[model samples]
Target: MSRSVSRGVVALLLSCALLLTTGACGGGDDKTSASAAEAPTASASFEQQKLAKTRFVANAGLAAGATYQWIVKPYRAGKFKKGADGRTFALVKAGLAGAFTYNRLKAAVNNAKGDPLLSKAVAPLSAGIESLKDLGTKLRKGEAGDADVGAFENIINSVKDAGKSAGAEVVDKVPSASQLGGG
Candidate 1:
């Protein structure tokens, strides 16, 4: 071979070796690298947190009755299993409640019409949503225990506290008979 051709062959071999070692240029197993690259982004941004908090409060006000319906009614109706070992129903109920709350918050966040406070609330709410999602996954997998429940409760509490901190008041207070009667 000519000297130039020989040098070009050597360069090509070196390039292939580098790609193989670095798992780039398609020379190494792509599955592992692709999965690593494809891992879902889990970090919540500031705007997400703001939106989460705002939506949480709005849902708490707008859907408080629904929350009670889904989480409390079944247990009261005895449709849920009884006994300490039968905590699955309770966990599932709580998970559903959390999921609803998170969904509402996410929607509100996504629908914000450029509100600054809503933007600021998104990150924390996003983190809370991530926690709630993990809790829901655990409940679905039958892997939630007392500790998981406690953690989930804490997350919900934090969301509430964040809402209060953001100056959002509870707008769903019980109305007395006089108020109901338009007195």
Candidate 2:
């Protein structure tokens, strides 16, 4: 191949590779490279990131409620059993995972200072997380009653409304009180 054409092709390939892989091009300066980890959050400006984090928090709040529903649907019929032990264990594990995600998301919401509307939703979501943890503990101890289930469901429903107020579609699949098995 001609030298000019070969160099052009090499440059094209290098640019494409750099674009696809992050931190690919510039690695000369130590100070700038150290700040690169914050690059994504920096690109949109902190205000934009605060708004995006608020939306992310709303979605995560809804997901935390959904996780409880995911584990509780099977247990609507009876208590924890020997065969159900694995499922119960899995549910509790999932609940803990949801807790971690929710707590982090909540922290993000708290840190989102630019948007004042997002702050209003924090309380119900916090209550929902507390109830979720309580439900997991009750289920683990084999002391979960219909009342406990009802309370968890109620807290999740309240959080769904709170999320909507915070500008998220959280109640898309949530049932009415009658559809919640009316215990």
What TM-score would each prediction reach against the true structure? 0.43, 0.47
Q: At residue 5, what lDDT does model 1 achieve?
A: 68
lDDT for each residue of candidate 2 in 1-183, tens digit (9 for 90 to 100): 996567656644643342243222112222333354356775545555455445445444544444455445645644344456444444443333233333433443443333455556655456555545545445534566667656656655665565567665453342222222111
- Candidate 2 collision pairs: none
Which residue window of length 10 is worst by lDDT in model 2? 174-183
Candidate 1, residues 75-180, lDDT tens digits: the string is: 4444344454434444444444444444444444343322355446544566655655555445533465556655544554554554565565434323222221
What's the residue-level lDDT of 26 in candidate 2? Answer: 18
Q: Relative to the unseen true structure, what is the Cα RMSD of model 1? A: 22.7
Best by lDDT: 2
Candidate 2 ranges with C-alpha deviation above 4 Å: 1-46, 49-62, 65-69, 79-114, 124-128, 171-183
For each candidate, C-alpha RMSD in Å? 22.7, 17.9
**Candidate 2 lDDT (Cα, whole model)?**
0.45
Cα-lDDT of candidate 1: 0.44
